[model samples]
Target: MTTTDTTATGLAHGWYALSLLHGRIEAHIERALQSGHDLSVREYSLLDVLSHQHNDEGGHLRMNQVADAVVLSQSATTRLVTRLEDRGLLSRYLCATDRRGIYTDVTDAGLALLAEARPTHDAALREALDRANEDPRLTPLVAAVEKLDGGPKAS
Candidate 1:
């Protein structure tokens, strides 16, 4: 059975339900992040991803990795980085060891914004998940999301 398969045959119903859940959560988070932080979902996500970087070896992420983490294309990622840099929220510098590679990192302002927005993001997420959990269609998915047990491990 594939994701497109119907409820009687496969996972289309589940797949769509998950999509709806994601959309709702993202929308809610976006509104919260925007109204409170003046940042878009992608921007906030980029800041959050960059905030995870460190000074240790391999702690830095290349642009492609950043793009992949934020679910944006490389060009789109570069554009986003530029926008944030203009706002003093992010900075791009050449890799110390690899001149050909550029690294993007959260600026002090970016980290500050991310720290402030983290609570809003978490609250919005919990609120959205809670609301979705009330829906019969999404209840199981919510449980699955909150569950501690990892998916079946490979032998």
Candidate 2:
């Protein structure tokens, strides 16, 4: 005697599919990063936020602001920042206007690190793109993701 609901099974399959997709992509990124960069995914995301912050400003961001941008807990962000700071990739300075706030700025060392890592990152992205191209089913999924990710609309 078996007890299985068709609708519930279908829903479970859908969830499993999404989870598998997420896991595969994350693992691919991890493997690619391991080959060329010293950063974990979270750390790389923080660096990305800092790079954009520098681009938008003279080159500094509040520590809290970075924590918010990266969606990390305050204490976790602080620890991550401390690690980067110790590596000379970034600096933390007392905010002159608000003594309670700390400002973070990427050092020249960080910029050089970004420069050195960009090519490997780009290559990894290209490899992913190539893999996607080889899979016909993924084309529609990619299109959907692009739309959700804010890509330009097709005519």
Candidate 3:
């Protein structure tokens, strides 16, 4: 059935539209980053978090903290971090004060990759968003997306 028919049958149209928009945007960004930089969106997001944490916790975060920040389960975060570590993008270190805790820090290579991926990711997102905004039916949803992005609303 068509989306309009589903919406007419009592589906929440706004949420359905938002979900579709989110998936499309995510897929676009994922593909762009993967083809351009050999990075997944999750990996890029993890590196971005690390790159911005230089002033806090000595530029490192406990594995649990990284998991929380990245919205991944601890095990998933560990696996992802391990993969990045294997690639020399990040390192895991034993915490000096707390033997039970391990910290993850971005390596120089991670920073370099993030630097290269940032522009590609940003351009892909902007292109996808602009395409979404071009759809007249998505006007309100586009405005909501922009507001969430801290951008000025279209009048």
**In the order shown, what is each candidate's alpha-carbon RMSD?**
4.7, 4.4, 4.7
The superposed Cα distance between candidate 3 and the true structure at residue 143, in angstroms, equals 2.0
Q: Candidate 1, residue 134: CA error in Å?
A: 1.1
Candidate 2 lDDT score at position 86:
94
TM-score of each: 0.88, 0.71, 0.81
Question: Which numbered prediction scores highest in lDDT against the true structure?
Answer: 1
Which 10 residues in a row give candidate 1 its minimum summed lDDT? 1-10
Ranking by lDDT: 1, 3, 2
Off by over 4 Å in 1: 1-9, 148-155
Better of 1 and 2 by lDDT: 1
* TM-score for candidate 3: 0.81
Candidate numbers sorted by TM-score from highest down: 1, 3, 2
Q: How accurate locally, in lDDT, is each candidate?
A: 0.92, 0.71, 0.86
lDDT of 1 by residue, 53-105 (tens): 98999999999999999999999999999999999999989998989999998
Q: What is the lDDT of residue 102 in candidate 3?
A: 82
Q: Model 2: which residue pairs collide?
A: none
- In model 1, what is the error at residue 34, expressed in angstroms? 0.5
Per-residue accuracy of model 2 over 61-155 as CA lDDT, tens digit each? 77777888988888999999899889898887776667986788778888778777767665765566556645664555545554575546679
